[model samples]
Target: MSAADPTRSHGPGGVHPIARLPEEWEAYFEANGERAFRGAQVFRWIHQRGELDPAKMSDLSKAWRVRLSEEGLAPPFELVEVFRSRDGTRKLLLELVDGGRVECVLIPMSKESDEDDESPATSGSSAEPPTDRRRKMTLCISTQLGCAMGCVFCASGQAGLVRGLGAAEIAAQVLEARRHLDDGEVLSNLVYMGMGEPLHHYDETARSIRLLSHGEGAGFGLRRITVSTVGLVPGIRRLGEDFGGKVGLALSLHAPSDDVRQKIIPMNSRFGVRDLVQSLREYPLPRRRRITIEYTLISGVNDQPAHARALANLLRPLSVKINLIPMNVIDASSLAAPSDEGVERFRDLLVQAGYSCFLRRRRGDDVAAACGQLALAERLVRPSASS
Candidate 1:
């Protein structure tokens, strides 16, 4: 039942590490000629301890470690590139079993005036090291190889759809990140906003959520996770059906009207604002849970104060919060993020009209570490699907 049992019958190996449920741990051990009790101990080391190397597992017999290692039961990934931003942001480009690379980010929230020194943790530490200072940290992980939803403004879209990552691939990003933290520095938040639209890769994404939130995996509470999409109606509704309030939802509604939205976010044309709002009404949002509407303000395109008014009118009734993200510059080059004053004015209009609003500050712009930039570089270097 140990978490490290590769033969565990959780589900098909769809890329994620701990996609299978914890209950299946015992079954995996029994089949492996080990006592059922070994399952819990192994699972704890992998999940609770965040241990990757089998040799470091002191609780398990030496024979089991050799067996596991010889069988190549370790996580199927290698960190190929680590790009650090001046603003305490670290983006890791990981190469998968097939030699394709995906990007994952670790954004540290710190009040320190200077950037913290860079030090990647060793495999021996499964537990996150504690930091000297207290600051909220969030991990951004990818769910798919490349996105099918070709949002005109997003770099992840230009690469086209390659394939969806399995549950283990997605979970491994978080598990790998745990090694870098100081003690007591558990991940405060997780966002499916890295490269792919999570809703398009639904089942594996959902399974990954269950694994991360499960007590035997990352043990992150559901509230700490956030799934973002460019308005995939079917997936949005499915969240309500399956996860209910276990995780948070963020909708990428870049425009208040279909006309402007379709130009940037094509998915809006299929699921218009009306359908999106209607779906939200039916979503099983948790108590005090307000869905976040992500609006990336593009200069002179959708940044007009009038658009803000229209947005306020559109969302007046829904229990929602507005996250005004200024557009991050990328090669697509068709749009520009709104100025600070323009973003502030838009927020003022929302607040004056009785809506909660917050401006998402620009981070890692120098390193292209902002929202949709890393995916662009990764796409260029990642082997084509045919390769």
Candidate 2:
């Protein structure tokens, strides 16, 4: 099926059983003449064990299991493809109930390094003690099938917005992605940087977070999940207020000033740099955690040393670290990727200015690992979101 298919959502309009909380499920069981504890059992079976087939839930009674199966305890989406890169990155293409498709990526992180050493692919996970050595992977998931924030450099938004995924579809990505984990390699972090502007659909995005982080559910840590945005100020503030700023926030600040930002990030005209920085300052980011600033360096655009200085000056007041991403230049975009030497110079200036900065190494390039890259050809061939 095509990646984009307009369909009714299971959000405010409807609620999918996969998106239900334990209490909500408890009520559902009681309403259906079943025991209340069955709700928790069903939830554990789905979220904790990643078992969608009720018949496989060994603890549940035979009748209850049969009833649950009849009620359609099935996966919200099917895992259609798994493309693995040489560097251990896996991109999962998922087809939703209404024939809509999205992608999620699992990227293994570099082992812990010294403070002065270069860092790993931006693992959204927080820092642990250096003594701990474990293989960690971060899954980059999509909140929409296609994006609304048409950033100039992003492959995801190249095709424009299709539709925001429902909370069930959003939450299900993790449950499904977990099933593909390799032995001894842990799924430790999540970054919402795959195919959409997460904040554009704030309600469903927030609901998915709550659903994933609930102890009785997937129990994914809020701090480990980074929500990347293109500066939707109200949604950013609401995220801080709603989650008490526990959720990691990463801003796609590709340009230092409004003039440059407005030229590249179409949404920058709505939320200017000053206002976005002010919102970050107001955020209640936990003690030791810093807001991540994502800077995509495009040649002759935002990669000059002067631009770096301006970026440092603008973000100086806020507690933040910079992730320098060399632009993934595509044929469709007029922008060109910054030279390796130029990228290092930009990072040098940021480091000289006393900001913790790291170059975000591109993983899974062979597999078109970057967001929506795998779909780029297909999207171009069929621009229509028709299924």
Candidate 3:
């Protein structure tokens, strides 16, 4: 089956109803004896405005609205539950029509003003503060129900793979996440860093990108989206080719060497660290845009100064920025994150080596919404047992 096939039903020639591009929608309308403009209208309603209810679309004729409603143009999943962190992060648990559940998270960016108190506004004159202090939010979306990557530190991979999500199911995460945004805030960025390794489900991930970046649809620019992978070489190369590297690519390189990497990320045995680095070198990244290197720092494992220096040496030639995530401790593994001092020293080594490295702050930990922490908390099993 073509990757473009929609999740549930297919019309003549296997065209998916909800996953159609504007051109595809145009063809569908043409086949149904309707004018081509209807395609663009429907696309705008769904993508631009986030309106899925046919009756709520005011411009379309009642007959067309009824037909569209009957065709199942609504969201593919129902919101099962939402867990909100004290820090304003919200983790959404959505249940697909087929009963498969996936989780997505809404993360608000830290305010720039909070970093320093030297701002003119802090001088306490009679000037009114800017009303637009609302922080931009980034949505972390999942591409599969459970993951097959089996990263030893991750909760999602503990249960093994259930199934990959469809394009509609993947894209609906953003729509669902948007509903939880606070007033004056906008969904500014998207990261496929939730529950699953995106590259494992390449086709659906690609299609979801198309739907999200379509001008008439979600209208998100390609640059604003980041797809995270656990060093799947073929998928990395394919994504670079398919999108010309316009979409942001983040590699989860937890360990510097193959031995350590394979211990944590099982996929590394097949595609080694050297091969992954070579692939990164060849990725068609646009000028001035750097691929993000996500290195999860585990206690006494990959968080030592020597490991940090090795990682720096490995990525020395690539145009990349490193995000040092002190591993989010999960029930499935005994693996623990490094101490704050250890994490800081690791970052210092990378920075001293002339690499741009930032220690990623742990977000939404109170609600189990941090990285590698999205799976059902109650069902988590030991990594040794799961493997």
Candidate 4:
């Protein structure tokens, strides 16, 4: 909000076509002396059909199409590379117009059906991706090139924040991901838990959500898109109010006690565990919707019988389900997931305490695409941390 700000997370000219809502696009066209409906047409082409190339928009007059091409309606990024895993997980490496890179992953999964599971989150892991045709693909998208929070165990934040992505760049990842889906796979849900603390750049993240959920554009159910954060309390409250508590909220509460959370999640030093749990009490979670608690079980660090019991006690008040992710191994990181037996014990403690818990299976590790493994800095760049 000041001249001293590093850089605002926004697209060129302050907004990109992919990021503009239908009305915003209509206004842009009206301001340009063109028919207002052209805005909706273009929006549908870009989001509803994943057509970003101006040349591909056949519905427009040839003259207008040429003008749009001249005005630059092409996609904002290029698909640099794709690494496909044996388990039907494809990791997309994208190069932005700024020369910064971000990775988005497509995991074709046999998720718990929407009718069967009432939670807003469509993310749940099975031993393998679906092969029998009853499947939905979850696209994990990034909000920044590198992370600022500097969590010790996460690769994304190991190097300090490089730059936050614009709303167009963030939402476009979903459109681009949809284009890459195989014939049998369908893109269903989205997760904002990719490369950065989404709430850190609140404006851009919120704008992207608005664009994605716009009925004429992507038209996604806000419930199907879960925005995961490391419990920035203010952001959590704003999300509940801004989205009417419809967009799913997942907390990366890796530990129940501040003493342990501080060691792993540096952001926890500012927002404590007790404060986070209390904030959810005010979160306008819809009926039958439960906030998801993501606990990363780092071996010998926070994985213990006592820790699990404390976690159950701490979260007993909130209507929540726990996802126990054995921390994914990353380059040069000595930390790791606990032994299988230890992971099972942690889940057992939560289950016995009458909370739903699931062990998240690691997908696409061979291609470095699992959780906490989306670090893509060719050379480390450390910017001064603000939060």
Candidate 5:
């Protein structure tokens, strides 16, 4: 996390289709003894334009297109189980080519009547025209198979850590999401708030950020993406220096006090709140972007008025925005989500203290796909971390 690169490979098994745009295209052209220019064309067709079929690429010669077909370049990650909420939230369970599955979600923003406009984001470009009424859809992506930082409240960490995903695998999640949009509807924002503690996967997460913002590739501006962490201090410092002005960082500061935090988050012992907040306070932030402090308010645990005061005191020095998330029910617990009134009380306390605060509403809870509920079923199929 201290600008030290993570140990990586072509990834275990073979090259994942989503993670290997460069290698696969290069390999294809090399095997056919074709000009290198073919790689660029095919890359644009797939990543930039979001074109699936090779035949759909009109710019490529018919023979080359036929060769592409014969090579069988198909989209990776098959759609298996899809869950739709009546409220317009959709959860997609995708089966990777190797038979492993991961979840991706699409949360539609509420659009007003006359402002119902949508446009496809160019493959590598994250540019979207402004609309007074367009809903901001956020795509949550995963960085690792399972999380290493096992926060007790999260189902995703229940299975423990699997392995980190490569940069391509991370970027592929965004690419795959684009396919489901109805032609012109653009994915407005992206969050690494999915399953894993992103900063722990250090190298790939940073590399994925570069790929997403690369104008010739995925092209999502760093400003539009936020990487969430469960208090990995080294990662916070590294990201501040390396990705300083590009991307936003969100810390999962669930509990304000160490005594309470350690019980809920095991990582707290290693990276305590004092150290974590100090790093966050010192981390260079972009002009308009403030670091988001995500706090999950548990009913009888950390939702008290005293807890709010402690939290406000903890974040006083830094440029921070607090996102209060009610403890939505997790399959492993008996904790009821804090009542609407409880959430309001916490928000009002932070606001009166002159801090920016917002409540994160739980979505797709019926399918166990809401916040704190994205535990993929593959946890049973995959091997243990030590294995």
Candidate 6:
């Protein structure tokens, strides 16, 4: 089976050629009458070195190189454009093979007073080097071309879901983002928090994680990856079971009550908050790892003190850290974030209720890189390209 064949015929053991793990590659090589060690070598060459051109793989013989070339290795998408925010955030737009476009953002963890002051100071003078002070970057990637979950506040879901991305299309976003990293910076964390709800594409997302965290691949620690979902109960349970809860899970629990949630996040009508909380309780989280509860504070909506109290009460049974995001305004919606004073008051109520809570500082708002603000403008300007 030649790689150019669009059928994507699996190797001897049903491994997709491009997404094969090391052991699968070994099985393929053994089946193809080649040494098993060549599999590991090929895996490293493609993932570790990011060398997809089989002709550039110098370690293999001429005949083997020709065979591997037939079993192609290429990225499923291409980077189209990048919008850099004044605050050092970069929003990347990628075009898939079928002409579908998705957006991803790269956010650098800040070291200014806002972030540093939050951490308690040490007693003695710090001996850490200046290079250690460089902040780690988190790349937010998309699981689908567009979102199916019609969250009233998110721009990605405004048009409805286009299609789910393949595992290679998902992992390629990381490889493309890494090329734009600045000096003294390292890509540390990854959030499935851009463009689409990750749980909507569970199988492809799971395979992408394995490809990203494999020792021969991107090598990211499982702890460094966070998958955000809009309370997809079955997907949440499956993720916990598959990864043994080692991967970070972030729940988009925007409202305290089912009535309020259903209005903002339509998915709540399918899986209520009660069911979501039950799913969280069953997730086998590792010790000291807390599930992130993302509550977007919208003006005159879910930002009231009573709502905060209810949220705190609702989460009392589970181990969680609350991140209160003042919603970013979108052109498609008239909804807006609560006032600074109101947001602070809401956060205070949660804190007084004995829950660890934080008012998340909005990042990259100037360039439309904040939460729920991606893909809408691009979709408007490039409507023809999207089709």
TM-score of each: 0.86, 0.89, 0.89, 0.89, 0.82, 0.88
**Can you write out model 3's per-residue Cα lDDT over 242-349, one digit (the tens) per residue?**
999898899999999998898898898899999999999999998988888999989988888889888988998899888888888877799987899998888898
Give candidate 5 misplaced runs (Cα > 4 Å): 1-36, 52-74, 110-133, 371-380, 383-387
In TM-score terms, candidate 6 sits at 0.88
The candidate that wins on lDDT is: 2
Off by over 4 Å in 4: 1-14, 110-133, 372-387
Per-residue lDDT tens digits for candidate 1, residues 1-387, read 233322121333222235446665577678778898877776677676767678998988999888656645577578887777887777877777666667888787443311222222222234444444334567888887777898877787877777777776787788887666545444567888887888887887887888777776567777778898888899999988898755788899988998888888867768999999888888888777788899999998899988999999999878988888898867876677678899888889999989877777677776677655775665545544431
| Poorest 10 consecutive residues by lDDT, candidate 2 | 113-122
lDDT of each: 0.73, 0.79, 0.78, 0.78, 0.70, 0.78
| Candidate 1 stretches greater than 4 Å from native | 1-17, 70-72, 109-133, 182-185, 383-387
In candidate 5, list every pair of residues with a backbone clash: 48-123, 118-184, 119-184, 124-217, 124-218, 124-219
Model 2, range 1-387, lDDT digits (tens) per residue? Answer: 112212322423234567777887899889878889988988887777777787898988898777666554677777878999999999887776666667889888654212322222222233443323546778898888778788889887777877777777787788888777775556677788888899998988998888888888777778877899999999999999999999999999999999999989999888999999999999999887888999999999889999999999999888888899998877568889899999999999999999988898888888888888876644423224442
| Better model by lDDT: candidate 1 vs candidate 3 | 3
lDDT of 3 at 273: 94
CA lDDT of 330 in candidate 5? 68
The C-alpha RMSD of each candidate to the native structure, in angstroms, is 5.3, 4.9, 6.2, 5.1, 5.8, 5.2
Pick out the ten consecutive residues of candidate 1 with the lowest summed lDDT.
113-122
Query: Per-residue alpha-carbon lDDT of model 6 for 1-387, expressed as tens digits?
Result: 645321122334365556777898899889989999988898887666666767888998989888777665666667888889988998987777676777788887654312312221111123333545545678899887778898998888776877777676777788778777776566777889987788888887898889888987778778778899999999999999999998999999999999899889999989999999999999999988789999999999898888998998899999998888999887778898799999989989998999878777877877788643655666522223332
Tens-place lDDT per residue, model 5, 1-387, is 011111232444334333445556678577668877777677766666666577899988898776555543455556776677776677777665455456778776533211212342332234434543344576888777667787777877776766666665577677777766543356777789876888888877887786676666667777777888998889888888897646778899988899989988999999999999888878888665688899998888888888898999998888888888888666676666777888898889999999978777667766666543544533423532321
What's model 1's lDDT at 322?
81
Q: What is the lDDT for 190 in model 2?
A: 76
Clashing residue pairs for model 4: none
- Candidate 3 minimal-lDDT segment of 10 residues: 116-125
